[model samples]
Target: MIGGIVGIDQDIVKADVTPQVDTANTDISTNYIATSNDYGKIGGENGSDWTIDSNGVLRIQSGTWNDESVAKFWSSLKSDDGSNINAGNKITSVIFEGNIITGNSLASLFDSLENLKSVTVALGAKFDTSKTEDFQNMFSNDSSLESIDMHMFNWENVTSSLSMFYQTGLKSVDMTNINAPKLSDASSMFYNCKSLKSAKFDGTNFSKDGVKLPQFLASCSDLADVSLQNSFTGKITDTSLMFDGDINLEDLDVSSMNLSSDTKTSFMFQTSNNVQDIRRKSITLPADPNITNSKIDEYNTDRYKGWSSNLSGDIVPSLETYYSNNANVGKTTWTLVEKDKSQYKVNYIDQDGNLIETKNESGIIGNPINTTKILGYSDPKNSESQPDLMSIADNNDQEFNIVLKKLAPYKVKIDVEYGDGHPSESFSVDIPYGLTSSSAQVDQSILDKLASNDSLDLDKSKAFIQRIASGNPATEGDGFSLSTVISGFNIDGSDFKSIFNGTIDFVNEQVDSAILEGASGQTFDAFEIYFDKYEQSESHNNGGSTVSKEITDINQKSATFGDKETKLYNSNGVLIPNIQLAKNSDWKNDKQMILDGTKYYRVSTDAWVKASDVYVYTDNISKIRVHADNRSRIIRPNGDLSDRALEKSTEWKTDRYTTINGEKYYRVSTEGFVKASEVSEYK
Candidate 1:
């Protein structure tokens, strides 16, 4: 050793060593340490250990090594046996080229580098599939790792259970030959790795042949878009659920797939092709072409044209074209085409080969015609000019113009002709000037008042008058009283009484002189006159009772009875006092006698006796006579009998006999007799 004293110049170092023990030039190994020379080489049997700074980049010396030198050196050196470097050491970058690094056994050689930033296995290098576990573990702990290029090796027989690839900050992954098949459970394989923007899959190699598609893109919330390159032939039982969880994906295209309408809920499309065929065929249009005409008439009119045209072509042109031509001339033609009664199809065709429109035979002949003829005009030849009749001679023609008067309108008689000569009889309807009473009134004030007030109250007023006067009682001298006439007739009964009594007095004075002595002239019998007077008094009393009871019942039932005492009929069927009850309370007794027509009375009977008189028994025997005329007699203490007569009694006689002062007294009467008299002093 020529004095291993190293001379150091500023930043340059030079070292020289002489081989003491040299066996062969290839087997000779040298170790040298140089400081800052920028150029050095060591020939060795074993690979040299190169130590770089903490942040230094180690690369193969390119310019100094020729192809022959690299070949000779690398061939002789043991190929990168990393036994010198410990496992789990830090590494910055790893790159390999040529045959230096061969199999994944090299991965084990670098497995100790936990802080590896990048790993690029060169082409033609073999990756040991069994060491996938080792490399996976290495990558899992290595957070500084940025990229991995395993494209060189076909990673067959590699069972990679590493989900760490997704967790890593891997910008790109080259899994070109991954051979594992059961990847159905690998959900979110690339979840949240926003750095990964582009990816591609070869359909042949990376196809989801039996694998479900949802497993591939599940939980990919950021995956807002998707595209399919080819037709999807797989059976997607529920395509709706495929995108059910992808809320961000607003649109999808299943146009490439053969989707069935049966499974689709809402298939909105431009045509009916997307809908089931049966539904599209069910739509139909109505048979009648003209909307203005009734459907029945359109059918019948077509039939009439067909029938008339079939008689002769000259009489009626082709039935189909007749209406079209006539419609231009403002005329409509009815067609009646012949048909086989059983078959509804119109068999006849026009010269133009159009089917002749036909009406249904059942509908045409079976329809019952309903027509009404209104009275058009009325002719009055001549009428006398009276206060009530129109004058015909007043006009120059001496004929009354009996045209239907607008003032008193009358409707025409209408008759309906049903089939088979059956004609409905004509009837007349009174033509009302207006719809209702309110409309008929010309005055706006009256119409307004009528509308504002209830019509029922006015109807009640008319009914009130009719209810009080309706019966034989009003004519039978038993009429309404002062109170009832005031309430029911809605007038002052005292004023009515004054007017009526004055008329009666005037009539009586006129008849009084004529009736005084006449058997020849209009004579009045005193008894008949007296009976009429009595009946008038009785009727007045009874009519008042009926009206009072009706008003009372109405007032009691209604809480809203006004102060003006509204007159009402007895609708509740309350009995009027002094009116006789029906013989049977059941109201079905026809044999019951009619009192005042609407009432019945119970019948009564009485017994009659004759009195006997004696003259020898001196108990002041008095003789009295009773007449068959209705009268009564009573004996007085002065020995005189007072006589009272019944107005219209039919029969009467003595009721008893008495004896006084040794003389028998006879009780006799034109009416019934009462004989309890004192004896006279002369007797």
Candidate 2:
């Protein structure tokens, strides 16, 4: 081929040279590493050589490579080309400086270097998703790698999908010096680093305007402590699983943390609301300024503390003494107070020199015992006046009864006291018994004497007799009058006088009237006198007969006139006056006129001895009788005399007639012969 194998040899030589050239061209075209600068050009001009020094700095020698250039170079190095530099070799260390490696290609570089121990990227090197598959798995299998300081780069919008520190053997981490000005979207940048012990978030580059991520340093059980800057405004919604298995985080300070609505189920301790300081062993309660012994007892009881007598020993000195002294007091403060007029409140204190409770017992002070009057009478002791005693009993159910005897009128005092030191006071009621005539003041000395005595057993019977003996005398001529006494005693005087006078006078009058009216031969005229006198005098002058003998004399004269009848006859004895036939004669018509044997009356005057006078025998006439035997018997016998006689007898027989000679007779009837019509015309 020296110009196509020199002409004649030229033709054959030319053909050989063309095939050789074509073969070389095909090799060049297919080998990307050979053509790429990704591998070293046959001279030492391209490709990257990574080296590590004893000082742990990773040195990388490259020619004009940025992150894209280094990534392309590493891609060639990991390819299967014969000219590739680090293919299938264990890289013990890598020192890279001033390189811009990024994207999934850069991660592929580290993945091929299985034995890589140390890698050092340049100070301004930024590895991104395109240069590597998130670069997170770049150091994933590199357990020998110990440290990483990626602070120099501006990781501002760099999405850290890589958790390069997780698989590496890192014992400690320091995030204090990191200035993540644009790292707002980094949620869990170091979520599961178990070897991490300490972390710091004291920078001002953090934004407070969004929902914060939880467990940013979560499962690092060795991470017992953390510090947060005051300028942090991240919201924590779910911190529950953040420390789920952390046992050493007892005193966590969450005071500066703000929570969102989703942050609710965080607390795990009992009495969570009562916990104040998270660093202390016990919590302080609200200050109870007035703690009483009773309150303490109640608290103790509620807490199930056993009862002890010493519980109240710490009470206020005053209250303690009151409790110890007054055994009747109850367990509450209000019970210690006495509800009465005095209104005294007891001051209670506890052992801590603080006032606990107060009790008021002043209500009962100065209250007097109530007294009531009981009506009663004492036994009579004297004849003159009775010693009636009135007593008073205190109405207080707690006190005893006291008897107060009468000392005088209109004033009564009870002598009693409440208790030992209380003196007996003199109290009097306005109204008193027995002395109505005059207002009299009770003798204090007498009451004092009576009160001082233990018993009230006086001889009231003897006293009464002595009082009567010493009574004021009645005035002269002021004889005891039943009417006056009865009026004073408010009794009916007439009834009293009637009771005082015996019934003997009335009985005697009744007996005498009965005897005169029912006697066998007594004249009715005599009975009239007695009955009239008795009736008129029964109630007057105590039944003394006010009518005297003159009345009796007139009665006797009337009786005699009624018993006798006188008839006037003509001198011729020619029946001039016939008592029965003189019905028209004025003289004969007198009520005193009667027909009798002493007064003659003729039936006819035709022919007869012209008798000068006629008279009926009256000397044989009996006293005027109310009943008679017959009309012509000259003395009353059983009546069968004659029709005329019977008729005359029937006329004389009445309730007003008297009996004479066993015949009925009126006051006008005479004890004389019968009429001539009865003697002659009937025969």
Query: Top lDDT: which candidate number?
Result: 2
User: Over the stretch 249-346, how does candidate 1's per-residue lDDT look in tens digits?
Assistant: 22333333323322221211111121221111111111111212111112223223322422235534233344334432222223333321121211
| Best TM-score among the predictions, by candidate number | 2
Ten-residue stretch with the least lDDT total in model 1: 549-558
In model 2, the runs with Cα more than 4 Å from the true position are 1-58, 61-89, 99-141, 184-188, 204-215, 230-232, 235-240, 248-251, 254-258, 262-683
lDDT of 2 by residue, 1-683 (tens): 00101111110111111111111222222322222233342113343444323323334543333344232234345445565554324346554443433332233235334455544443444322232223334444445554454442334344332434444444344444344333343333445555554555544233344323343444555554555443234543333333333332333333344433344323211212222212111111111111222111111111122222222633332332344355433323211111223223333333344443332222132343222221111112211222122112222223222323332222222223332343434343222222111112222222222222222221110011111112212212322333343343343223211211111122222333222122222111100000001111012222454321000000101111222243434423234345532221111111111121122223323211111122112112111221122333332211223232232223322112223322223222232223322221100
Per-model C-alpha lDDT, please? 0.26, 0.29
Model 1 residue 429 lDDT score: 26
What is the number of backbone collisions in each predicted candidate, taken in the order shown? 40, 67
Candidate 1 lDDT score at position 635: 43
Q: Count residue pairs with overlapping backbones in model 1.
A: 40
